[model samples]
Target: MNHAGPSPVPSIFPQFFAPGNGPTDFIVQDFAVVMIVAAMMMAITYKLKQPMVIGYILAGIVIGPFTPPFSLIKEADTLNVLAELGIIMLLFVIGTEFPMARLRTMGKISFAVAIVESTGTLLIVFFAAQALGFSFFDSLFLSLALSITSTVVTIKVLEDLGWIKSKSSTLVLGMLIVEDIFVVTALAVLQSFAAGGGEFSLPGLAVSLGVTGAFIAGVLVLGSRYIPRIIDRAGKTNDYALLLIVILGLAFGLSFLSTGIGLSSAIGAFLAGVLVAESNSAAVARILTLPLRDMFAAIFFVSIGALMNVSLVPMFIIPAAILILTSFASKLLIITGVLVRAKFDNVTALRAGFGMSTARGELSLVVVKGGQDVGAVSSTILPLLGVITVVTTFLAPYVIRFGNKITLTETKKSDGSSNMEESSSGVG
Candidate 1:
């Protein structure tokens, strides 16, 4: 038998970035692999009677370092870019499906529930952490981190279920917006406090607040008028009809602009969505983006799975459990408050609770990551947050599915009002 020298086999991670495969190209390859896997998992999850969001997240964990694949992942930065695009699209799509008038009509319930839920959740979470002997800062940040649910996720699940038109669904969206705004403010305040050696200056912090306020005012004031004309003009040609290039530019431009002024990029993206909401451009923007967003979003969820430090779960066992429990309860409380008073049956309220349970998509990650970049949280906190997010994301779907079944059975014929209109842009 001829002795063969050490066999050379291309490894999965490096094979992704080998010679002649540019980083962007390789990034695309890794992205494709992840999305395909996640998509397949989503199909399986649907068949197995779970939410697709949970399926996508479970796919991440299975191929993540925790399970069999124990896969070495790559192009994390590129995937992050794609994931953010998924979020922007998520928000923009929500905008297209629900008009401002509808959002406002749900006003009191949304306002009351969001106030009660978020404020109540934050207090319970913070006090609970302190009672458990975590450091003050740790408790504050942990509660802050855990209290807010992912808008990207809550909106997507509601959209897929066609519930945005319902009073409850609309209430959820309003709650999510309220949560996002709170988190942004908390992040800003935290960053300032951290920067100033654990002391907060109301006067100095106001500068940042004022800057953010101006950005919002400018966009809403100008965008409602200006964007409609741009959309009209751009609709003139196929290249222009898409008008995605302009959308992308403005979204990214505002993101960078916000960061320059000390707030996070996600704040910019949310504002961008709100701005885009004003014009007829919302529908046109969705039409231009369906194929691309669908493709990129799959990659994004996969990459999120890939970025997870599955290793941490083994070490932070008790803390992780508490965090997840606190998070789940907080969300359930918030969503329940919103749905219950809307006079939803106990089952529907629980289902709405389940739907809102997933935490940590675009904005939460932005808050935590921005905290780290600016020296707020300890390095250890990042892994902890990552693990918590991974667990919650996979959990939301199952909860939602269980909620959906009970809800559908009880109210299936009682209410036809909950089916939010689909995007002619192709929610199908």
Candidate 2:
């Protein structure tokens, strides 16, 4: 038995690769097949009344670095890129739910809670990393990555549960938007530090902030005036009016330009949505994208599944788990603290808290990508983020369902208040 010149490298999955070959074969077979297996599992699990998101993640695990059936998808960079597009559309849809007035009426609580919650988790993770002896850059990456909450998931769940018209929904959406802004800021700062030897430069930072802001404002202003006409005219003739050529052209183009101004292209995309949200074309945009959003969005989720590497699991498992719990706690604390003091019931406060827990979109991905680009985090961070997004998105529906029940069951009939009995916002 001890006659071996060199021992075998004990593989996690032997059949998918040639004992040390690449995952090149998996792509040639089509990533759709990989997704099909994951989807099948999701369907079976969903029918059994389980959280199907977990199934997707588990599918990733099975098809990841460990399982033996299919391991040829490790080279799915193209799939990931499409999935990234999915992120933009995901936020686009989420923004459609927020409209401009909701942000204004929600008050500083929305903005304040987002800042408090994000900073709170950020500091905790940052300090924890420092205490654990991580370097400054590593700590920064860990902190930013850990603090993000899935705004897309939060809004989607709320919409699905029919709670988007409620007060807690308003707070959640406002704060989630705030959180999105924060994640963008964090990524920008990370990018600046990564650019080279300068610790801080006012001109660079200001230009970055100013340019991005101006771009957003300009798009919002210009888009508001022109987008409706474009939509209306195009609808009569183009037949593809919902996907406005001018708006799409501007959204992607401006989004590219926003990068020069220190903002993620996502801000441009979101602003594109905000502009339409304020105009007559908002319903048209929403109505058109509903089906396409579903299709592209699934590709996005499956692409995330395709990226999971079980090898990286050993490193991210603890961090991912820690970040998940801490992020949820921080959101809960800040939103609840702000609302409870404002004289809201515990149940409503808690629902507002749960709604703030989702943090999927360009912001979170940007953080991870920025970290990798800066050498602040490992390349594996990207796949881990994919895992996080898939897991959280899949779990969002249940959290939303529970939150609705908690808020509804705990609140009594309205007693002369202007706020609707089932609604959480005064505007609604």
Per-residue lDDT over 1-428 for candidate 2, one digit per residue giving the tens place of the 0 to 100 score: 11112212225445654645545564544465556766787788779765444555556455443344445445446555655666566556555665667667767767877787788888887887676566677677767876776665566566666778887787777777777667765565566555544366887677656665666567766766777566556555646654556456655665666566545555656666666576555677677767656555555555555555555666776666666666667667877887889788777788888777654443565566556544656556666666666566666777667666752323334674354234453312
Q: List the global CA lDDT of all models.
A: 0.63, 0.62
The reply for model 2, stretches above 4 Å from the true place, is 1-31, 34-38, 50-70, 133-138, 155-167, 185-189, 192-198, 236-238, 241-247, 260-263, 357-366, 373-376, 383-428
lDDT of 1 by residue, 328-383 (tens): 78778767766767776665576557666665665555565556656666545655
For model 1, the superposed segments whose C-alpha errors exceed 4 Å read: 1-29, 58-71, 74-103, 130-141, 150-170, 184-198, 238-242, 331-362, 379-383, 390-428
Give Cα distance to truth, residue 339, candidate 1, Å: 8.3
TM per candidate comes to: 0.73, 0.73
The alpha-carbon lDDT assigned to residue 108 of candidate 2 equals 79
Per-candidate RMSD vs. true structure? 8.0, 7.0
